[model samples]
Target: MKKRYFIWFLTGFLMLNCSCNDWLDVNPRTEMKEEDMYQSEKGFKNVMNGIYIQLASKDLYGKNTSYYFPDLLAGYWYKTNNSTENYIMSYLYSNSYVENVIKTIWSKYYTVIAHINDLLENLDKTDVHFTNGNKELLYGEAYGLRAFLHLDVLRLFGPVPVGASDGTNAIPYVTELTRDPSKLVSVTYGEVKRMILEDLDRAEKYLAADPFMLGSMYDLNNPGGNGVNYTPDDDWHYYRQTHFNIYAVDATRARFYQWIGDKTQAEIYAKKVVGVKNTDETDKFVLATNSSYTSSEKGALVMASEHVFAVNCSDLQDIINGVMITSSSSRPKLYLQNAWISSVYENPESDNRSKGGRYFQTDGSYAYYLKYYESGTIAATDMVPLIRLAEMYLILIENSTLTEAREYFEIFRQARGMDFAISIGDETARKNQVEKEYRKDFWGEGQMFYYYKRQNKTSWSIPQSVTIPENGFVIPKPKGQSAFE
Candidate 1:
């Protein structure tokens, strides 16, 4: 029997808008062989762009990983009238609804990883010439994306790290394009960690010449920036932040290092991202100012300025509408409790991410997180933030000296409109304050659950007092997988 592969055929590939090179304007296309797909630079670009579109699908970051499932597990939303939300937020992983969600996440994530592996395999062996550093850009993005996807998989499915010797079995680190079942097997946590870091190292090396590192010509917020329009002559590297550019590489490194308790490496990479500068020495990625929270015309909700890596989800408005808004109140849906809103942002009047602020909308009984809502006025606002500059600062606060931590903390505080600062008395005080910040910072982004899991928190009190299960953090791998799956 002929063996089937996981690679999507070029006939099923995304149709390109050759008129302007805008990736978001994809349509259906005709068939081409795998060889023909990679015979030119545009083919490679299409494949890469297809992978991103897949990532932004509802099955992945666009809904589950970015906000819905993860945040529910983190206890961000109340179990309003939705039974599935109730089960997930309560950590009833064995429930059929929650189980289906887990199964889908596992299946979709690996499918995307397989596609990435196929792209890398073809990219390295092909003799096609790439112009203006596009080759390096593509290579870096592939490697970085592989690492990024695997790391998130590990975080979601792997055991919580205790130390270097925590030899528990973790998810498979798939690096090859094969449909063979025997090739897929779980490895130790340490092994997966090592593989992820190795890929990141390669990504960093290849991305060294990334346009983001070279100059600010691709700056999205700048007038006449390449992101403004994708002309036929324009290089595809203008929206560096939307891709896994070098700073994203560093930010991911910081996040992974922090996950493994490697404070030294974590701080090193965190500071690197924090220190990013433009050609004129202006801060390349800085904390969001108060205007970012108050400006209703812009995407004040998502805070694009601080985003290190964000996904341009074409379905963002749809996701927001499905989860947070509607014309009729007859449907039971996902929403935050009034208590959660008040508890997390205790000083609601002062904090821009609080109840009275633009980050949430109230209906007298419940609050809706507005971070993912689209403004329609700015094209840049329609995104799901995967990583942000504020998180880099939080990591520094977690790993830096008390004085240094306080400085970063104060800066972040002022940016969020807190405008208050106090000296930390000791390590314990610093740790407590950082935890509070985490609760306030990552409301709908799906990171609060990871924070709780990382800290091994057993009990929480935001919406109400509840004890987390010991195995709650370890999401079970879907069972009955065939070789192809």
Candidate 2:
């Protein structure tokens, strides 16, 4: 039987309005012509903002792929009822609902990619005058976003990681805007890795020239300035950390290198992000304090200071809390699996992550994922971290010596209020310790499954004495993408 998939495209006439508080607050308008939309800097900004907004939709990073389904696959959570979520938790890939969700993830990500391509294709045709730095920043973010999405697509659908293996075919690395279906074809796994790295290389070069990275010297009157006029409102400097900053590009490179089994490059890039060689200068990225996670204040768990790059979504908390069972009577329930809870967080009192880090019901029947939970009105400050400092530390420990690994591991453990004196035996034991910490550190943030996939693990331990099959590691590709087939 022949299968068909729907590929979404950005219509040429649609225009988007940008919001100052949250750039991702883009509302669509059909009246503005495509040419007019890119005629000014504000228009270009709106276009870029639209890509982020689209990416944060429910099908993409907003829920399914990032938190809900992937967590189920990771065996971190389980279904309390026989709902669609239960089917997902059971790894019923053939279920129509599950298949549709996977397809939406595939289609929606490409939709964002298509819009990015549209923006890049038309950027030069517009007459808007941008500073050299601003121009580079715009292009850099566009390229970086494209690479980021493509890499995730490969992670979800491509072959298991096997040390830069060139034999397996992977998802197409889309670069240009194209309606020509004939041009879409899967590339070798090695080719996709190289393409992603090449894009990151360009992103790093362009982003280094960005004024936002210049710290205090970005002001116009300062010495060695770009001479670009700036005002408080026009200052894009503060927003730099939220976007694909230079450090985030490096963090992404570290992750990619580690996945491809290049521990040397991985350690180098990971060190750059963590500032390991320069402890005094490491204040830019630090571990979140116990209070940051347990505070009663609204939007406390966004961990704004620690995030290397995150999505600015005001409704992030609402989205996460909505998936949770707010009350005992709530139907279609979802909660952390008891097995995972016992395995990782045996001592809730000593482990700050269990005490107030991730919320647990008073009765212990359920533990709500509270990492994205914000208690008040959604604002620009609310964010979902895509890359953060803690993960960098994990990367470093994974590639370091046993003694060195223990040192790094203790730093993270102590930061979380755990006992720091835990002894380590050897390199293998140190690596196992790192993996255990990963399960606890990134519980609801969607890193565990990828961690297992990178290691090519065949089974995932679950609550009900079940083991996830090797096929479970790879989600099925959307049916209509013949190129990937």
Quantify all predictions' global Cα lDDT against the true fold. Answer: 0.75, 0.67
For model 2, name the residue pairs that clash: none
Please write out the lDDT profile of model 1 over residues 237-313, one tens digit for every residue: 66678788888898999999988889999999999999988767878886777676555435566777787887777
Worst 10 residues of 1 by lDDT: 10-19
- Candidate 1 ranges beyond 4 A from true positions: 1-32, 163-166, 221-233, 294-297, 375-380, 421-423, 482-485
lDDT tens readout by residue for model 2, 1-485: 11222233543222212333233332234333465456677778777766776666556666777777777777776655657787877788889988888877777777777777877877756567885466677788888887887888888788788653776878877777787765556788988888899888888877876544444212322333455333233455455656777777888888888878889999899888887221223255667667665454333455555677777664554565548535435522457654456677646667767764355543355556556654333222456677878889999888987777778878888887786456668876776777777787776677888888888865645333446665777788767785444
In candidate 2 the C-alpha lDDT for residue 466 amounts to 41
Provide C-alpha RMSD values for all models, in order: 4.1, 6.0
- TM-score against truth, every candidate: 0.90, 0.85
- Model 2: how far residue 447 lies from native, Å: 0.8
RMSD of 2: 6.0
Q: How close is candidate 1 to the true structure, as a TM-score?
A: 0.90
